[model samples]
Target: MNRKPSTIPVPVLMMIGIVAISFSSIFIKWSAAPASIQGMYRLLFTSLLMLPFARPYSGALFALRKKDWIMLIASGIMLALHFLLWMGSLKFTSVASSTMIMALEPVFIMLGAYFLFKEKTAVSALLGMGIAIAGVIFIGWGDIGISANNLKGDILSIGGTAAVAVHMLIGQKVVVRMPSYLYSLIVFISASFVFAIYNLLMGIPFFDYPPREWGIFMLLAVVPTVFGHILFNWLLQFVSATTVSMNILGEPVGASILAYLLLGEQLTGLQWTGSLLVMCGLAAYLYAGRKKGKDIAPVLDNAS
Candidate 1:
């Protein structure tokens, strides 16, 4: 008889992951380097730091099939593009506007999974997506008023969201077939390579950045890339994909709160309302998924 697969508990780990990843924007803002240069620095430092844990030079990476290699490269390239668009969006938009627009990631993830991977979406997922969209629309209406600059930033943010979704969707497939650590090492390495090339191509002045900017870049690598991605990969082992998707809704809220605390950026009433609705929708979806997991555990155990 086959045994049921073990999974990590989702709630606390997922929350931590989102909050850690949400710190990227603030860190980027704190760094004085040019956006693309900052991204390049962050990716390089993050890949080097993750080396101890990921150990990509090991035989395990060499043993991976050609398909896994492709996934890793694709994930890396997509993530690099995601960061490029996201960091660029911040230049022309408020943190609030950029974050709110970037929150559309989960929506694309859900839709992409349904279409690309043929993952069945629960009615609850559809409903949660609707709620999240409404919340984004509400926030957008309030703080993202139309201007040429705002429109440009909004477009870039949306492109970032799409890029990340493609990255995650490809990553999910690769992780199921190989060790997550090995797969992630490839992703980090590829991202670092892509960013380095981008910096070279753009001719961004990287040599003049001060030690303060380097310090911020180091912090960003440790927090969001290593800590956040590790936690997110770990949480996936214990939770349903839908549960993980719901938890990502916390990113924008956590980011907004952090910005308010650190930068004195204020959150409007509409933003607060949207955040609450997002939380509510996520809560509703996760509650149902957890109950379903609990319900299925015993029957599968008995079969084993």
Candidate 2:
């Protein structure tokens, strides 16, 4: 007998995902490893952790259509690029600048949706997005500089933003048909393989790191990779890609707070105001989404 799959509330999952991912920047900052090496370990560890749950759905994996595999592969590669470029940017720029630039991903996602899906965005949603972006800019006001290195970092962060936007756009289309666990496992494995190859080609060692670095790698996998990204992937089955991307705007607020508390990075008065603006923008965005009849309740109820 066929049975419907049980589901969690999408909003709850999104909140958890946001909180989990907010820790990602902090984790990256704490690690002493190369960006590629850290990325490889993060994805590799996540793939291993997901293997057990994913094994139960092995039959479904073989049953995926060719087009699905293509999308998954592309999404996985893009995901790898997003991490590599964004992490690399962190090496050259302030976390505030890097994260604020990366926050522009929703703009790319919205553009892709309009061109590919013929999706029309609401005015209120657009306003909310603008406000959120403005808030991030304000938060990063003093941090962003025009030096050559900062320019390079900004470009890399923008590249990462584009990569993730494409990944999420593909995910929205594919996750509707693929089981979340199976989808996550395949994508994680694909990214891990790509990063592993990149690390090897760049002469980045896969091992011999200190125990603290290993622990940081493991935390990266468990917190940001597993709970953060995997949860977002699951939510893609319910929410629009733009919505998912917009939710990520919350990351800057959380990341800023975490940086201040843990890393002793002080926040300025302008940054505090910007943080409030970000929260307001997010609330308006979600409220506007609901007003436009884009609630996830029906989607959750219909999931099988």
Model 1 misses residue 243 by how many Å? 7.3
Model 2 poorest ten-residue lDDT run: 295-304
The TM-score of candidate 1 is: 0.80
User: Estimated TM-score per prediction?
Assistant: 0.80, 0.79
In candidate 1, which residue pairs get closer than 3 Å at backbone N, Cα or C atoms, i.e. clash? Answer: 7-238, 8-238
Model 1 has an lDDT value of: 0.68
The lDDT values for all models are 0.68, 0.72
* Model 1 misplacement above 4 A: 1-19, 55-57, 146-148, 231-247, 288-304
Residues 104-158, candidate 1, lDDT per residue (tens digit)?
A: 6656876897898786667875787678677766655655654468657767877
> Candidate 2, TM-score vs. the true structure?
0.79
Candidate 2 local lDDT, 100-173, one digit each (tens): 66665655677788998999888997887778777766655544433567657767877888887788788888
**Residue-level lDDT for 47 in candidate 1:** 65
lDDT, residue 183, candidate 2: 75
